[model samples]
Target chain A: MTAQPTQTGKIIISVDAMGGDSGPGVVVAGIAKSAKKNPEVGFLLHGPKDVLSKLVSKRRVLDGRVVFRDCPDVVTMQDKPSQVVRSGKNTSMWSALESVRQGEAHGAVSCGNTGALMALSMMRLRKLPGVNRPAIAILWPSRNPQGFNVMLDVGADVRADAKDLLQFALMGASYARNGMELTRPRIGLLNVGTEEHKGRAELKEAHALITDFADQANFDFVGFVEGSDIPGDKADVIVTDGFTGNVAIKTGEGTASLIGDLLREAFKYSPLSRLASVLAITSLQRLKKRIDPRRVNGGVFLGLNGTVIKSHGGADATGVSAAIKLAFTLAKSGFAEKLAARVASTAELEQDAAQSALQTK
Target chain B: MTAQPTQTGKIIISVDAMGGDSGPGVVVAGIAKSAKKNPEVGFLLHGPKDVLSKLVSKRRVLDGRVVFRDCPDVVTMQDKPSQVVRSGKNTSMWSALESVRQGEAHGAVSCGNTGALMALSMMRLRKLPGVNRPAIAILWPSRNPQGFNVMLDVGADVRADAKDLLQFALMGASYARNGMELTRPRIGLLNVGTEEHKGRAELKEAHALITDFADQANFDFVGFVEGSDIPGDKADVIVTDGFTGNVAIKTGEGTASLIGDLLREAFKYSPLSRLASVLAITSLQRLKKRIDPRRVNGGVFLGLNGTVIKSHGGADATGVSAAIKLAFTLAKSGFAEKLAARVASTAELEQDAAQSALQTK
Candidate 1:
């Protein structure tokens, strides 16, 4: 491998410059934004050297701060996870993840196919010990004082059983601590109701299991929380099966976008309304900043040996930069190591709880 | 039995006036608004005679348009469904459903505990001939020209198999035709992904089954849709199990409420924004009216012997009125009989499809 540009002692982020809806240029711009804001961060940009070089050379802030890797293949959104795992070695997404696997970068950031990224991530970085299923955790804007709550298993897999949910609680709590800097984050299992008897059969089982681990895990178990409580400050870490979590997140996002569109149309209905919009533009912008999905752009892959942050496929420069910032923070804090340690003890907790239950019986 | 004041040949509606969070006062006010706007509709108000009479007497429009049923008990929100089923015969919710069961009222409307109401509905009204599980269908604001789309199984039974989902599609299509007045409504099965192999095993089976029944059922099968399409224009009717549907709806509502609250806070942050708010009051009101959850407040119980509308428990008089309007429309259209006819033939269709599959095999 050729020696590339680097800043001594600066944290390096592996960036997949291809496969985003906005193309490689936007990815380059996003890394440049991060590079300008944080002088202590550099990038391992993976994509076509000819295209990436042109884009990187144009950004003055990125001078001597980026290492370019020539990865000619790109993973499309439509590619199946299984297909990508078998034949995607040359893709930018795979190459980017390779840097993290080889310890050449602190973490990897990609705006590629989510399923494929997760699949490649699992193959390249490997699952941490004691994790049956690795999960993707994202920050959801909430009524909490910290302004965001962590939700997990958003789209890692469609199904999660009772034991899986217990592990999610462990991982989510870890994320809330290291990622959000919360000392003792409260975990809530997502269900149809807060009542113990409500929801699927597995939820009742998961409830008991999560409650058993909370004390030892150093996080408070808030018990069951309904979907309405997701953004209502009931819990700092909302946990659920990926199918339900994915649906809930997308539904929330779709509703917000619809309202935003309607709000703009409402303001444009008349000349007087248009004038009001102009006057209130700053306030509207403030509101936009408060609830913007773009600000919380990264989905951190938990229960993995190396950190991987998945940015939204359609994320623009601002959104991508927000994701990079999140990746840098997690990498700097050694979030992957902490999360691995937390997950590694899950089996011990379960075995102890089981033994105590036998004694009580 | 007390004699009711009524206009000759007016449609009668069964209404639980006690179980709502707002009390009988709001229920009486709601029916009164309905009476004033719709002269051809009357109500059987179920509650304590003395208490309901006092509330109804204050509304001038309801002077001669309501029948009072002296049901003395009230079902609070905390009541268990099974407990209510065994011991709730005297409660207003049960009494209201009894009216629909005995054909005294065309349909039943309630703003009470959803589970209790659904249980009482099934026990009192019973399921249609071929439905394994009943569903609650609600109108969601969407980009369609009709301004809303229909979604089902919001909070009925949490579990729905492939056959149950097929029944939901038939019932949802019937609702769109009757409720939304769409001739041939398009139906989409909700999943985490639009891909055929992405969701649960049952979803794949339901997808094929829905596609098979679409043409004969008089609706277009739009195949699979993601949660984001719940508010999109991809389909007129979105179908899912009660657990997923309930989460999606509540998550959407919770997110919208949070955004609305944040928008208000943003406007209040500055004196300039305060001035802009005053100028944009009309535009803001216009926007509020367009997406007001209160305006679309009813969740219709499908595949039942009689129509039942479950309004939001926290709804005010306006939301109650919206539900009553829905009950009135469905009652006027003789929706129960049409839906019965549609569902009555589902078993036959399934049997025929089975025969065809056997022949092909």
Candidate 2:
């Protein structure tokens, strides 16, 4: 494959070509698809040069936009997050993130072990100033007019104190604004019940803190929201600790897929139903497209010095392309820089809220 | 309404008729539906005698099997759990639970405030011996041959320690056995990841304790399961703290409904799609029935001294009847007594595991 000259004004995404369940070939193919649609997008692909070259050579769309780096090592799924951080210097994941840190790429995309990728990204790009814990934000298809809602802290860690939650609210607001193009996104704290007196102690404290910052942050604080409201129009951004958010998103995915599978089974039950299925195939396809998880396949790592999008480890070519598109959008919109400024501006207000909570206790 | 003598061998359920979102009419209609199908089922309906008599008189199937207690007070949804425990003696919710405690009914069903109902039940019936916390378990529709999987503590409380999780697992296993009739139910600890090393410290401890007790408890322990597995066939029962379980189940419900709404919108998008929808109406109805929330509407409060099923507050006749049927099945199967015995037998083992966890800490 011929190496292209670096385009001065293009949005360069550093792609980690190793560690995906479907292998680097799928990643390369996905980037080629994105490059064809997005003429302004370029790639600094990191993997074994020989392997990546062979794959990229097969895709004509990638000829003028791809640059390959020979990083022979790979991060295995079994590798612990701590082990990867300490010993994965030569791996493709490390190289991809390093390119972002060094300003060679605007952002990075990885379809690898989530824990390992998160660890490497944090170590390489560092957290934005005044942010306590970074969060993973994903767009959930919802009943809203926009057809998507943002939910954050989907598993960067298992815990979040009141301060971390306040930061999540701000970071999430910034993400919704940039990604969803909302001027004032509605933010809700995820709890067991929507009532004010429900949920854990930290969540209650976090609710108060977020309420205090809502006006200054320029987002509509919708108070406490139950899990059902996460996919409803009640809130554009739902904030929770990583543990709850992680479980909720996965459960939602699982339930939707189960229903889809059962619907197919119902259509195949008899000759009459099968005839109906054939006649209804086009309408079903439209419905399928509306709810397809692959259409929104990236989880953006928020509150970092630079943005990094984590594609599903087992994502196919279309899913990978979706992640690339997300990275390109965030980079072009300067989401990482805007989010940093949002969190930094609220640092004093968060400290005041914490002090008040401590005084009351 | 004509009064009748209490039957000698019928299974009577105490129904709290005052506080449902749809009022006593729906509850009375529901019990009448259940009574029509099962001659052995009866109801000790708790509400104002004059009001219930008018509703029962409208349902011909309820004529001979209904009995009413004149509890004029009602438990409002806004009543605090603590407040209800103190001053709810005259309320219909309290009367319904008291009947179960007094052995006048085999089990109880309530559609009032969850917090109020749970508080009254715990105070009245008390926790089973050696049970630290009682859980509310619900059957989630799934791909299992039995068509459902048991998940608990869907919200009796927001917290559960390692010992509490162990209790939930044992209780959930018993529920699966009695409710779904799995001889040796597969029990899984719900966590962020399926890997043993990938969650909170309490979850790790709970995993170890549940693993150790699996053999003696006569349930198969599937080490750790993620939210995706909640609706899958990998486990017959999924256990978690009430906070996580509550959020997960609600999130799953919300996602399913969102998809359902979107599917309808897709089918109505154009004349061609609308025509296709008409042809596929039968297949669509079959699919809808399979995933209807009303078909499995009850949340059974497990590990309590007596059984109590909490129906959805806004449940229609069909949903209320589903809850009644669940209560009836648990009563006939002797679920509460069996669960109490299981917990009593496991007391020594849980104590040992707690001690081990403490020593390790």
Candidate 3:
């Protein structure tokens, strides 16, 4: 609705206003909520300019805080990741990431298809120097003092070799430091058991490589962990290949959803139980808030040239706001810049490890 | 304890009494519960003679139904699987499997270390004629009419090829029919997405092979299903490789545990909330009972020559009984014999599929 002034000093996030299941209206509402809360945060919203303007008009709080980018095409969930990279230039998700790439926005946030977003981000922003495949990292609710643990490669590339895994450990450790403000993070490679000879061949190799890299990278290597330890207090960061990580997270989410649905059903069984539900509403709400997926709604793409956070495709207003808040915080912290510096040194060290491994053999 | 007379005509199961966290006392209690409930079921208990006899003597229901086997050694949870396969002869777990191998018991049940148990089963009983990898299938609580869905390769082996996955489909379907009594089970391959092109290379090959053999195998192929669909009402059988499957189930269990802990903490926050928890105890208990992991505690090893079930290593009396009941049901159904007949025809079909693919190329 208004021409944006020079907010070059402020942390401006490139927001994809389309592609999410809740549509652009909720996206506007989410950003408006964020803008009202943080004076230093602004948004470069990408969508159909006319449609987004009408939605923004209703939210007077976002009158001067938003800069609209007219992206005519919207990326659908059904679109293949490879196809989108070739011909999805005008899509809101693409435009949103482009703003960050072109230095028009500090970082980008999108509630879109995970595969497509990761593919587009890699192609547009390119990978960091030594990063073979980019990873998607998310904060899992945990028993730790930080309230959450980080798990990587949730749904990026489906494969990661020993060297790639070594990179993930470094990138993940860096993420913990910048994102969670932890000085030294505990890194664990996800396996079936905490045994030396357990899991796949690559895992065994990765375990050896990561153990060597941990001290140099300034993180504690908790050699191996099982799926249960992902949410447990054993490690602050759990690293696994994209395929396993994706299934594991989805399974966790599915189980949580099932428990919630079953609890609601339990509370509705009788008239007395229905009255008990009202009395326990506050208590149940507290439990829900603590484990709410929406509260920690951003999946940050690691090993990227720029900061990109992928919000849940079905995210509502609250979820979208959570993603926006995360992007703003990371952008302010200059997490991506610092991560690049850290990984730049990793290439030489990885090569030396490879050389030593070969020589020893 | 009274000596068992003629269990040759009964559904006698070889029970490993020394492995579970609760020890032989709970194992004895579990079989007593089973023996009391089902007069036809009996046990060939494997453990130290003196210890097992002392425990079983206390349970009057198992007086005539139990036969003691003197096994001096016990398989600890930390025992290496490979080492156990080579030299764990006198251990209770090995003795338990030997009974099934020698045709002295209809089936075998153990609460030993999973990897060790699987290794011993393969070494003692061997694989079926056409099956490459044996799978550990468990009943996952779902919203289906049967209230559970079968998921395979939970941790039998960490790797499986395309052919191995097709066999998993056949074996999982067979498990659904016998274990859950589903006539024609609907099978879905686990992946990150339902798209045919998604997931690792082996999954795509498995998808094509499973689809081709679905009709011949007498199971409905639901193409690809995501991790969320595991607990959903979509399919009766969900198949995946052991590595991914293991992570998924463990992740699901971990999330459930987290929610349970948080719910308990939430209820203790305030006096009113504590009062509300008391009024809602019945409702909460109902929810807990519906999804109790101990209630459905057996992980059946399919693609093996004989029936073997691996119970949770930490199982108490209730969990142990659940595994025993499952063993009794499968033993009575002659599920192993029926599955063998079905898989006998599969070897020829698989060979033909491979030949056709090679010729076409």
Backbone clash total for model 3 is: 0
lDDT string for model 2 (A1-361, tens) is 1112267668899999999999998999899889989999999999999999999999998877888878989999999999999999999999999888888888889999999999998898898889879999999988888889999999999999988998888998999899989999999999999888899999888888888778888999999998899889999999999999999999999999999998889788777777767776787898888778898999999988898999999898999999999998998898877887778877877788778766775
Model 3 lDDT at residue A309: 94
* Poorest lDDT segment (10 consecutive residues) of candidate 3 chain B: B1-10
Q: Model 1, stretches more than 4 Å misplaced?
A: A1-6, A354-361, B1-7, B354-361
Show the lowest summed lDDT stretch of 10 residues, model 2 chain A. A1-10
TM-score to native of every candidate shown = 0.97, 0.97, 0.97
lDDT of 1 by residue, A32-112 (tens): 889889988999999999999999999999999998999889999989999999999899999999988888888889999
- Give per-residue CA lDDT, model 2, range B1-361, as digits (tens): 1112266678889999989899998998899889999999999999999999999998898877988889989999999999999998899999999888888898999999999999999999999989888999998988899988999999999999999999999999988888888999999899999887899999998888888788889999988999998999899999999999999999999999988887888778778777767777888898888788898999999878889999999899899999999998988898888888889888988788778756765
Model 2: residues >4 Å from true position, as ranges? A1-5, A357-361, B1-5, B356-361
Model 2, position B38: C-alpha lDDT score: 90
- Write the residue-wise lDDT of candidate 3 on A249-286 in tens digits: 98888889999999999889877678778887898898
